[model samples]
Target chain A: MSLIIKDLYARVKDGAEILKGVNLNIPKGEVHAIMGPNGSGKSTLSKVLCGHPDYEVTGGSAEMDGQDLFSLSVDERSRAGLFLAFQYPVEVPGVSNANFMRAALQARLPKEEELDAVAFYKNLRARMKQLGMDPKFTARAVNEGFSGGEKKRNDVLQMMMLDPTYAILDETDSGLDVDALRIVSEGVNAMRAPYRSFLVITHYKRLLDYIRPDVVHVLYNGRIVKTAGYDLVDYIEEHGFDFVKEEHP
Target chain B: MDTPAFNDADELSGKLRLALEQAEAEARLREAETPDRLNEDWRFGRPHIYAKALVSALESDTDNAGRITIQAPAACVEPMADDMRDGEMRLRSIGSDKILALHLKRFGKGICLCIDTVLADPIIITYETEGVFTPSTIILAAEGAAARIIERHIVRGSGLLVATRDIKAMAGADISLELEVSGESTSGSDQPRAMNITNIAAMDAQVRQLTRYSGLDWAREETVAEILHENTTIELFSANRLHGTQILDQHTRQIHSWGKSTSNLLYKNVVDGSATATFAGNIYVAPGAHETDAYQANRNMLLSEDATINSLPGLEILADKVRCSHGSASAPMDEEQLFYLLSRGIPRHDAQMLVADGFLADAVTQFRGSESDGNNTKI
Candidate 1:
């Protein structure tokens, strides 16, 4: 089983098309990394998967685990095990991080089940200590006034807490330092399992060195132009998108 | 006309009777016409809209030893006739507003709060009332005395409430005064209510004032203060939330009478449903009051298209070498922030509240000592 997108086409509400005729399949239990240049629709693909209201899907379809993903709302898509870690996480100024996480976890539970405050805090503090995050952040507003590195780590913390079956990290390593990168990678690796999958979208090859994607794809011009193993990373590091364009053309 | 300040009054003390008679005569002789759309300040506040309602006095506690909390060293606790105090409430709250005159002619007994030592814990005065409740208080902080006083009122039912609090801080006194008012619909249609607050600061005194008003139906609150001495500082914050057919009119004034003094005011409003909220903040710096710093701001958010908010920030500065600034903003919720929360699997209504909590975060943070309570509040 896999998340399959066939000929996906999307555009801004009134602007020019951003995603045009894209095809990709991320099979369960396999980690895939998509690297691309600027304006390659990497962020758009992630947003569309979560049903962002600003973008409209003009044609084609996407399905996850044999269920039509397009039929669900943004929140439903999340409860259906699809997750997108934002590149620029928005600040919810008054909501505490603890409360936000609690609401998110509560949303995932059955309707009659109430969230246990004690267990929730116990698990939250444990994960926070593991991520090297100060416990004070648990009471602070969600990503409000956080530094660039802090925001990225917060994104990873969210991903870890939710534990979605299929997760996409949209440029999660762009603004991170070397130390932050290693810490974030460890957080991701701790969540890696046979039943769960990850689609890592980044611009640099350095992030792949830590997460170690099993399959690598070159997403060029809103389409997966070439697919290979880790060797494609070496080729890109040497010749860049120039050779990918030559091969696809 | 609209609701009468009072329908009729029972027997009163001879002194209070004389003051009421004189105030009634003066109010009638110089009766200002109902400020309709013609007056600039009354553009959003149509004082002509009147509804008839009953009025009565709220029973007072005979022994208030339990009510008056002196967290600091004890000084004096006394109650007096306070006859002329009610008559002055009219001009003290807002010179142009005539509604307070009607209140003075009816009810007139209040409490005087005085502290002589620095307080480690906040002094809380809590009250619950029904019917037409008229409660008044005066706070006095002696020199070098530091204290935090909170007056909280929770009221229910359809009746008018006339409240007045006069505060004074002497030299070197650090004082904080907080007024938290909440009203609920208990029975019938909720009637209009009026509140008046005034504060004065002496030389070298630092005073911070906060007022949190939430209403169902209709409420009118007037908060005003003046820096009377040199080298003093004052800060004022207001937060309001209204729903249903509530109509709220808030008037605030900051006056700097001496140079080398600073006064700041910030007001935030959130109106939902078919409610209407109005805010008017005025800052005045007297001539020759050099080096005076005055600032005022009003921010409003409407939860629905039908809701309305009117904000006016006024500044009158005649002194040179003075710094003054004022701003007012009225807008809806930020859609981008809303989308971000919804994508996290939060329900639609919960997401709306979260964004609202964020919009009012700045004002919430200013509530001193509230953060240490360990309660998760998205205020």
Candidate 2:
């Protein structure tokens, strides 16, 4: 019924600890926003969730509906309904966006089975149109020449296409303008079904204005210090992480 | 041995004599009044490889493989010109004993075809000589008619085979030629040796030629193409994939005789399993050949650590107002690109195969052209 992260501790490299004893949980049909300032380990939490090879989990356990998550590889975790919209999505040259997404989807299909190209393209076109993306964008190389806002929108496009059970949007609004942000939020909100969950990690509350979160958590110094309702975003916007900083200090 | 003079007249004759005598090849040699290499046209950069032959015991029970198909371009005629089949031409059928010979040449305006009608599915023209062997040459001349031809060389068994072909396209006549060669397990248990020379003259005409050699054991090939005329253009592309100790050395020369003439050459080599490849290209622009443009480039990729590639691209210009450029590059696969594919759930070996296939795909793109026929590529 939920994704539970209990007593999580992670390191950037060999012994450079970044996440220390963090705990959070997001039940089905709920949207949670994690707000933290720079250098707070919010990004590390997203990367660790996706099983990035560079980040090592020393002591932690993450489960989705009672199924262990850490045991899966990065791509396996992706196929198993966990998605991470990277803060800075990678630019893969010579690989078109349509082809990359097709490969990812093909990996999830049964062995020796083929993907229906006609149906797949039709679905892709519909999703792209809903996100206000140009039809020609599917043929262009993945993020090779995309602008900052275009890259972020492309990340949202991918999340929408993958349709993961739980999506971790890592700073999805970092590079977006107001118009792009609104379009991305609309795309995300359209996919907000009762069976899906989202953990939106960002610094600003402007994104929460369009896609309201059921709960808000203040993540500071590698741990979630406080949890509140959607009004917590307003409080953070009024002041800052200083209230959480004072209590933690 | 020392390198011969750049303008040696006897080089062609000498090569013909040695090749004809060693392989006992039969072909009528038209003696050029200018002594084949008498002028500066034939020899600009001397191309020679250290010769050595490993004559293995001949196998008596080698299976007979099927025939190889050599593709030639369909005939085309200009708007107001006479058919090229009636032009002056000379045909030569050499090495009919052990080699399936077929030569088509149109220098001025005639069709000359010399075919050894007897088809040898897997032909092997071996070199039995003890010293350096000269490759036989097939001379084709077209007075003014356009011509398209194809020559396929298939080795039934392993044996050292040395051979060459010389084609001349006369003034205002276009000619396109292709050679496809491959080898198999032979009775002799030794690979073939091949030396090929092609001379093309496209005076105010356009010419395109492509050569592909692969699946040879210890095969060595040398190709030389020269373009001579005003407003004439030549598009030359060559690709070779060699395995084992196969060594391929290719040299190309483009001469700009008149103003506004253009030439381009792209040669690629892929070597694996201790194989070696060498590419040498030279572009020459003569004086008064104003507005001449030429480019020569060689790219090689080594598939294994033991494989090696040697490239030398050069340019010589005598004209003050001309554009000419040449370059040579050799490198291994990109490690970052490979890692990225492997990290995406594609197995490491499958990832490597994808990269290798992509590397060779670009070289083959030039060979394909628009076709209205329904037999276009299904892929």
Candidate 3:
């Protein structure tokens, strides 16, 4: 009952290598944090896991509940209960936020099951209010002209609506103000369940302060070079990453 | 067979006579840019269209019989004939447009609609053609009159269609003209229209023209209009969808000769299969035409890689302090937008259609706004 990855090696399609022999595991009930500096491939790991088309997995094995993850297509991976909160959510013009969400949820149902419009809207309104979002936001074209904080909140909004089994958030805290950080963190915290696990990827320690992952790992040069408890954040903040690199190298 | 049925020397007066003579002389000498002859091969995709005069129902209805007068050439006699002759001459001097010449010569009869007062109901005109056909219509909304007219053309079969529409709005008149052109070739009806439109306005008049062409095998649509007086407004919107081996070529010009007037032209095209679309729009602000506000935009979305679109957005500005914006673009659907929808589990086809719908949604929504009037018209 976990998302287990081992010997993960990936590179940009016909370009430079990004992820090099990485390994990570998050059991069903635990949350893990991966922090690294720019060019260390923290975001690349998240995209590689979600089957982004630009990345090529040279050598790796990832599985959820003993099911082969690499065998599924991008959409298939998503339908099989895998979710990634993109750092920069794409703005889809002509598709309303509400309509986009409805389509996403509708795709999860069986072919014979009809989606209930009344229940869908009723549930959507409740979830939106919980995230402190205006009901009018549902009508706005998906992500187009959205403020930075609003787009991040929208990401969490979708995350809450999707309810995937194993969710990975890449830099979900970047570009957010203090107030927006609290709202997004609260949304994630509300979704924390014993059966659902999270791999939260961020460059800063502030996001960890909100989500409070049980395990912290330092990703350097595309590898998980160090692993520790939550207190490792205080050490890295007080001392910095140069010592960790020196000690690990 | 050579003599056109509308050719009655005593009945045809003014520019109509001169134009028919010119067309006949040109025919005798050679085919001089006739309506049947296309200016150029459609660069995107070409469809073989035959032009022939067809005999079918020319459906028409008008409101308030006392306030409206519908006439054909013979029904228009001496005194009113003089007035109609003046309009004919003006239409001729406007341009050397061959479609107008075809309307002057080949089209045997046309409806002359005149509304003298604000109408309680709207006017509806429907023209459906089988085989080769030609039709002409004239609309005149007299001074201080407010009226709406809807014109539809449904063409079928292997035939060429030569058509013309002329609209005159008097001072303080508010007129709306909506034209819909569609075709069904397999059903033996072809709506391939080689059409020309002339919209003339007087002081403080407001004219709204919306043209929509769908499923046309071959179409040549051209509209020319002038903001001739102060405080007049002209709004033009056109949307077209062509599929299979279809082609539509369009040219439009909106001139603000008088100061303190506004003209907006927006056209959108959705091309799929091996279809092609060509759109050229020109907005000119003449000198002394100060405070002229003109906006023109053309956007084309090619649904298939084989589909093609060419757009030319021209602006000739000679006035100071004129607010003008002109842009033209042709692009395939955004793959990133598609993948985003696909990532959410939408099927490939529905996802593509949704994005295409969004691409034309802005123009379509604005068009609906212009058409969002009380349409009591029943046909």
Candidate 4:
């Protein structure tokens, strides 16, 4: 099973086109990394996949395990096992992290079912402890007043809590220092399982070092110009995207 | 009865008539017609149309006994004496003279709550009345005493309620007052409305007041606080949720007459449907009241496109070396915040509710924080 995309085209609502005829397939149990230059529509791809309202998809289709992704709403896509770790997580004021997480998990359950509060808290505390997050954060507002590193860790903590089938990391490594990067990568690594697939989007090879990917694709000018094995990460680290852009042009 | 304060009902009516005449003369001299849109204090409020109805209701003499129920510690409960009522009447008024005069003319029965020692349990007062119910409450906290007072106004049938509270916090005293107004539309009952006017004078004490309104057709609240001595702290908070064309009008004033006093006010409203809310707050520091720290903020979250909010924040600082600020903000729910919650699988309606609830939770948090402190201040 895989998340298949065919000739995807998207653009900002009433604005310039950002993604043009992009295709990629992330099979289950495999992690794929997308390396792209600035303004190459990497972030746009993630947002479009998550059904962000700011952008409109003009053509093509994306399916998760044969189920059409565009057919679902933003929240429906999430409950259907699609997750996007925001590049810049939004701050939700006055909603405690614990309550926010509990609501998300509750949404995944049936109407007649009830979430076990005690077990929820116990599991949440365990996940937080695993991620090196302070216990007090559970009581704090979601992502509010949090530092860059703390926000990233909180995002990973949420991903762990939700346990989606296919996760997209949109520049999750941005603004993270070395120590924070290590901890965040570790959290992502722990969530890797046989039934889950990940699409790690980043600019630098430093992130790929912590959470190595099985395949690396070079996206240039809103299109994937080259797709190769992990060696592409090192090749680009050495030569940059100039050669790929030249070849694509 | 042990020497009734007044000989007969005629004497009581005479005293009330004198008070009403004095109030009307004052109103006439000030050229204060029923507050309308032209009035600065009533610009966004529609109290003018109901002014005649309210006055006529006050003019009607309806005995409203046994409608108010009070559950309090026996030591702190007592009947309001005539002298105590007169003394409270002499205190500076905070609301419009027209309404206060009508309230005074109709005010006959009330509770005089005196807290001389720390009280662990709150004084609960519930008002279940209809058609021009006016009750006066006097809360006097002795030095070093701490107490909590909760007033619940439950409107079953359509009527107008004019309630006034006079609070005095002595040196080193700590007091908290919570007022909740909720109503239901009964069959064949006209619109239900309520006006709450509160006045507070604090001297080297800590006083906190919180008022919440929900499911009320219309409500108007006027609060005035005076800092009489140094080391006094006053916190005022209101969290209101309005739905279905409900209207909430609020007016507040923080007067700093002494130096080194602190006062803060926060009012939050969530207006859904076609409801509307208006908040007007003023912070005034006397010429010599230096080192005064005061802040006022009014926040509103409009849940629907038809919902409206009018906020006016004013600060007049006549003293130097003081720090004071006031701000007002009204906006629809943040799209990014909504998307963030929605992206987590929360349904749209539930997501909006969460954001709206969080918008008002800040004020409740501050009030509850102060409450806990008051609870710990018992000595």
Residue-wise C-alpha lDDT for candidate 1, range B1-379, written one tens digit per residue: 7743543464335656776877775665246443455666556766556312222122232221112233333443456355546434544645334444444544454556787767667776765545565556677778887777777766666544566677777887777877887776655566535455464545667777787877645666667777888878888887777777788878888888888998878788888898998888889999888999898999988899999998889999989999999999999887777777777887778788877876776675765544233122112
User: Chain B alone, TM-score of each model?
Assistant: 0.80, 0.62, 0.75, 0.89
Tens-digit lDDT track for model 2 on B132-214? 23233333434444444455555545434444454565655555555666565545455555445455556676666677776
Report lDDT per candidate.
0.75, 0.64, 0.73, 0.87
Q: Which parts of model 4 have CA positions greater than 4 angstroms off? A: B1-33, B91-95, B186-190, B374-379
**After aligning candidate 3 to the native by TM-score, how far in Å is the CA of B4 from where it should be?**
26
lDDT by residue (A1-249, candidate 2, tens digit) is 999999999998776898998999999999999998888899899888877767899998999878898987666677788887778876665467787677767776898999889998999999889888999999876777899888888888888877889998888998898988999999999989999999999888899998899999988899998999999999989998888888999
TM-score of each: 0.88, 0.63, 0.80, 0.92
Model 1, chain B only, scores a TM-score of: 0.80
Task: Please name the candidate that would achieve the greatest TM-score relative to the true structure.
Answer: 4
Worst 10 residues of 1 chain A by lDDT: A240-249
Compared with the true structure, what per-residue lDDT tens digits does model 1 show for residues A194-231? 88899999988888999999999888888888889999
Clashing pairs in 1: B2-B50
Interface C-alpha RMSD after superposing true interface residues, each candidate, one decimal: 1.4, 3.9, 1.6, 0.7
For each candidate, report its DockQ versus the true two-chain complex: 0.68, 0.22, 0.48, 0.79
Candidate 3 per-residue lDDT over residues B136-186, each given as its tens digit: 667777788776777777766644455666777778777777788777567
Candidate 2 chain B lowest-lDDT run of ten: B370-379
DockQ of 2: 0.22
- Please tell me what DockQ candidate 4 reaches: 0.79
